[model samples]
Target: MDAPPTEAEVRDRLPAGAAPFAGRRTELAALATAAARTVPGRGRLVVLAGRPGSGRTSLAVQYARSVAADHPDGLLFARMSAPDGSPVPPGRAARRLLEQLDAVPAGLLPADPAAEDPACAALRTALAGRKLLVLLDEVREGAQLLPLLTEEPGCLVLATTAGPLTGIDAIDPVILGGLDQGAAVDLLGELIGGTRISCDPVGAADLAEACTSRPAALRLVAGRLRADARASVTDAAAELAPAVPAAAPQAPKSRGATKPRGRGPAADRRQARELLPAEPVPVADTDPLVAAFGLVYRSLPAPAARMLRMLTLAPTQTADLRTASALVGCPAPEAGTVLEKLAALELLEREPAAADGTERYRVPGRLYPRLVELRSEQDRPAEVELARARLLERLVRLVDSARLLLDRTAGGNPDPLPGPLRLRTPAQAAGWLAEERDQLLDAVRDAIGQGDLDGSAGRLVTALLRALPLTGAAAPADLYQLHELVLRVAERQQAPRRAAAALLNLGDLQAAEGHWPQAEEQYRAALDRARAAGDEPACARALEGTAGCHRALGDPVRAADWYGRALALRQSLGEPRAEARLLVRTAEAHTAQRRFDEAGREYRAAVAVLRRLGEEEAAAALSQALERLRRLVDGEGIVQVSE
Candidate 1:
């Protein structure tokens, strides 16, 4: 019997990392149960269906992990896409599956990539006998994946997607409604703080209702208020009062026929409905979330309402009075006044900032998500596009400005980042990003989702990744999600240039996080894309990155292959300084693999390069390598050098 892929192996199988989403226990359970029928000779394909922010992708991932122990073969996940609204060919998804199975695919191998049938054949054949877990995340519909479903035993198929997979009636299908009342509250409790919930029962209850019990809504709301030390639960609840109602989705039309009424949890719902009302209320009459936001939007002064719509112009924490005013074509003072009103209404919060006079505001706790949802509802595609262009225009400028500041600073600067743009130190940069990083990322994501296909995501992602390394205060989950988002955005655009850069950055994160094989894959993918795009500089960077990954994996020979490429690329680009630095790194790899002669020559070359560049620090770095190589030749060894 062939060995099954381990959890580590299955994880590394993913081309890009996974984004972390909260609250989808019900959806996940449905997928797991559907997939549980896989036997030695018989298997089933289970489709997870939901709309945007419905938590389908998250559920499929969770189910795959939960059942990993039972099906040792491994898990393969893919996001399928095609031209127009046509289903992606099964062959394309199959190739992705094979790639995840540790099979180094030749290239983008899709013949009739618009057809699901042919694509599924390749995947079905690949799964002949070995146990495998396949997750088709975020597809157009179930029929697109129908061909990929295998009859072979020992294989589990998990298909998570947006909307009802109408044609998949023959198979098990579970529609994810909004989270239940109890679970939604529990999730909010976990995110917001048990103490706060306990102290202000009404506030907590109100917040839960305002969030519509949607996991994403609840988490978003909880995360916002958690930062306000002075925030009372009731105050926060009141802020989200428009969104406040109840946790559960309004009953399904079918369920309404059979289900009882007036048995819902009764608590301080009015206060909970304050924050967000952007997400569509599918059960408008029955859902408290709809009631909450409906009231908020209705009550707003027309100027404020118009301004609220215009806020699609602002990035999460970067929204200052000036930007708001400029975007809305109003004066700064006018915008400031409106901003305070939004805050008073619990629609925004001004975070504590340094001495810089610039102040920053976020959508009141989780209510901001509604703004995004609301933005998407414009009936006219032209209007939506127009709004997107305006928003991204402002974002492009903001990120460009931020990038200038990032480039000027080396490690530390005492003057401080001006205003609410608080990146004082590397650590502070990381902490600030970690704290508000999700909101920022969500803003960027909204930009892409609404089709901001220009190089805008590239710059925004650059700012994000640059900020990531410095933040030690963020959760691992948040860090990884950022990585996942960057990868997704780059890939979706099919812009290999951007993809390669994001891959290198993501590999750095993975390597740092102890995911070496995965890091190596990212590095290799980056190297391939860079070379293909004829981006010599990026190629060299990727090569160097791959070498570092190899060194971490204790594979000096492979490390040498990558480093040698980096050195050649640097040399070709006329960067003698960079060439020398890589040479020195190559020498260290040699020492690690116990190759003394080669190590010695590499060190000498590095020293020569450092002297030419007048890099005293780098020249000093070679001393330890010199000593180590000499010691190795004399039956001694190398010493660790500080960076």
Candidate 2:
């Protein structure tokens, strides 16, 4: 809270034999200059992009040290670990920064960033006036981290990342590159006592070339050289390779920053493998992010390989023990063990306890892109299907639970009732529905692809219709663009039952909005299809659609006739809820015609049906209708009888 243990502590704590922060003096200077821009009225964003171990951390750390004096208020270090081998996700990073700033308590972050943003915004408010140096490191998801940086003029934000954060270009970019040959050689000499290396020019150049000039690699090679009194520059250069796969797999680490046991000899023959690089890694050769990741991941053991792929199929970017276990066909404990190994190897990262007191793990940013590529190639249709099934099942249960807040009851069958479902009030429910709009649609689209039109098309039409009137939301561009997707599936699959049901709902929607002519077309078409399929229930709904449109257009006579037909059909089909609603509508039509006696009789029947179903809301409305008719027919009749 009181200015994160000063830069002095960090400097003193640097690992023994770590390079003397050399070769990147200019770049570090540039970062310092950027950090200085935070002058109480203007804020600065400095993004340092480079591959892992390209010394971005060293430069950023050194810059933090240099700027420490400028920001006496506080200097906060939140390792949103792209290099700490753990990918600190935006929410976790934000929470970490909040914790470091003493803004939010450690356990208050929400399970998801969507919910965590408000907490982060609160943190920003708390930090807004402070002169702080905040470093956001290893940003895999830039969008998530941007909100955490205080925009206050007093705070300096220096973010270290794998590449440009596409959405956040507001910051100046400093891409850290490996040192040039001379700088590399000079720095290696400094580490191993420059005098010894420079004493033999050719040997020093060879050593620098072999070191790939990357500070980490340089320090490593120098550590090995200094330890071996008999080792020559040529021998050390030969020991450090032109291409030591940036991957640091867990070999029993040797003492004092030793190079891998076999890496030096591998580099001595680098000229033979001209394609190999001598530097820390050019951030080239791996054309895409996946390629770079592939170079790192492809070397893992087969079980680890499968585990990595399974994690990619996780529902969210983060995975809990259960999710990992299911995906890997292992138990939770076994999954956690495997996850532990992945984290230890720096292939995965764990999030801090979220607001829910639950945590999840994920692949680091440095490894995710390659995992994505490997996953695409390795993900069989079967595996994807399995994940898809689990997700869809979960979604359906959630949606069903949501509907319970509407007071919808279970049917009369003896099936167990769903668990008590809680949701926000109607207004909040609508908002939530809006937020989940895309994910819900995505699920339906996938279901349609799987040839399940009844569920996909039906739920989609129901959701869109229900949400639209409440939300008045401008339909998403993609929603309208792909609205016809499920319709097409219904059409192609020859499921007239589903097709007619879809048409009836669409037509009913059109009719409700005063589009009578279009409504008539869809309803008539739907009616014909329903009749063709012997779907009496669907046919009745289609007729009801027609009657509602006609009634809205000032044709009570036609509405009455259509309502009668639907009522008879529903009675024949023995469907009580439909019969009750139609009966109530018919009674209103009779009242429209001033046939008070017939309207009273019909309304009484509706009240009986609603009462039996325990629909208090509907039964009350029916009782009101019957009393209105009684008032018209017999003025002396009591509208409310005294007991």
Candidate 3:
């Protein structure tokens, strides 16, 4: 498996060390002291918690690099959260650590629960005596760090998260805030050159405060200034000022209400001029961060802006050309062109090509919230809905088509898609599904929340459920959640047929997981809905599911009856394939009861149907079963039944 970045690689990825480190000196010193401390039985754990783009990651990396020589054994780094805002599984994190340490052979880690514990224990033992530095970045939960923490006294662990990791012993928590005024100015000087700062010292200070001294916001401002040397610091500050909403004047005090004194308009205007003399008064109802994003966003072409808004639909804030094309309803090449332009503007970071040779890009996490806000503000709710519908429709169709190519038994493909879509081979289909699973799941939830599932959302859910078994990308819990979302949407829309389908899917999933009672309950509910809606196909499906549940629960008599009913329905509906399958199932139920004669007759009937349908594989298997049953009945001196 491909490993995440190593300690040195992570450090190298940080903002340039040569750039002046202006702030967080105290926090850095404390972190360094913690990392330097060692005990006999306890390892050091230091967590830096702060908001997005608050320089938590930068500070952690800087501290680690500054004290890199303290631990001579090795430095390991792992990102404990995915780019899509999901926590990485503890097992995977542990496996990666073991791989990095060379404690286990590559590809030898077993996924089985019984075998995983021993593997983890062995890895911990391997690290028992080593003096190492482990950097876990972007940790969303403490459990994600449990597998990586060692009892080795000489080891040091430094982690960064959006919030504090509570319930951990001996944790030194540092809450990183914005840079102070002087430090923010110094950082700007380092990026924009000292000469520019000296030319307008007051303007530089104003720019720092205008950006709220957030390192990320400051960096964006600096990048803009750096790109255009002719652009003054005051000009940059003016561009960012609109992000700061003006304070609304307080209303006059009533008998019991108190009103605070405020500065006069003239004084306020004076202060504003000192801050950014070139800019107009800031408007209310705007976020500074969003304002900063707007400055950069407005610089792009219309297509790029449109693409940025469309990109918000991606939960992970990351995409390749294929997903981008689907979201934007454009050709892959055009989507690629827009992505490159965004990358050039630093709106999106271009990642290295994945193993499958597909280039991926990530929208900076700091900008995700603002992008969403912008989308909501710029695009109407209906327009957003339409765009989302198109995206879901395309993804559903694509995945459905891919599954058909991969599994001939997967049933019919979806209706013809409008645009030119890429069709992957069986081998590629699995990889594609895995890559897009998170996005698809997120889209499903979003559609449900927006009450826009009547068209493509329901179809996407159905297609995804069908594709999951073939790809194995989603866990059973994830499937359950998706189905539950579908169920809610179906009920909300008063669509009985959709509701029945969702119930049947839920029942099938529960049966696969050995929850027979729960599965039966769902199947019964589905049956009722199917009957109410007069949907024969759904009715047959529900009946078949109930039969399977009964069979699994050791009630073959009931299973045979239910299967018989389903078989009759399929035959009446002219569904030859479904009828043959139900016959095989019903025969198995009879075989379990030692009714060999009945089982043999059903097997022969199924084989004939399958042979006529040109299903060679199924027909051959049934024929062999029929032969075995015939011999068993002959040896037992049982009467043969004629079909």
Candidate 3 structure, TM-score to reference = 0.63
How does each model score on lDDT? 0.60, 0.59, 0.72
* Residue-level lDDT tens digits of model 3 in 141-251: 877777667778777788889987765666767888777767777788987799999887767766766667777777766766765678888767766665575552211
Error of 1 at 460 (Å): 3.0
Candidate 3: the clashing residue pairs are none
lDDT by residue (tens digit), candidate 2, 539-584: 9988988888778788888889999999999999988898898988
- In model 3, the worst 10-residue window by lDDT is 250-259
Give the top-scoring candidate (lDDT): 3
How far is each candidate from the true structure, as Cα RMSD in Å? 15.2, 13.0, 9.8
The digit string of per-residue lDDT tens for model 1 on 310-425 reads 67556543466645765566666788788877755445545544234445665442344556556556325565455556545554454444434445565433333224333344
| Best-to-worst ranking by TM-score | 3, 2, 1
TM-score of each: 0.45, 0.45, 0.63
Overall local distance difference test of candidate 2? 0.59
- How badly does each model clash, as a count of residue pairs? 32, 8, 0
The parts of candidate 1 lying over 4 Å away from their true place are 1-301, 308-329, 339-381, 395-436, 464-487, 565-575, 582-643
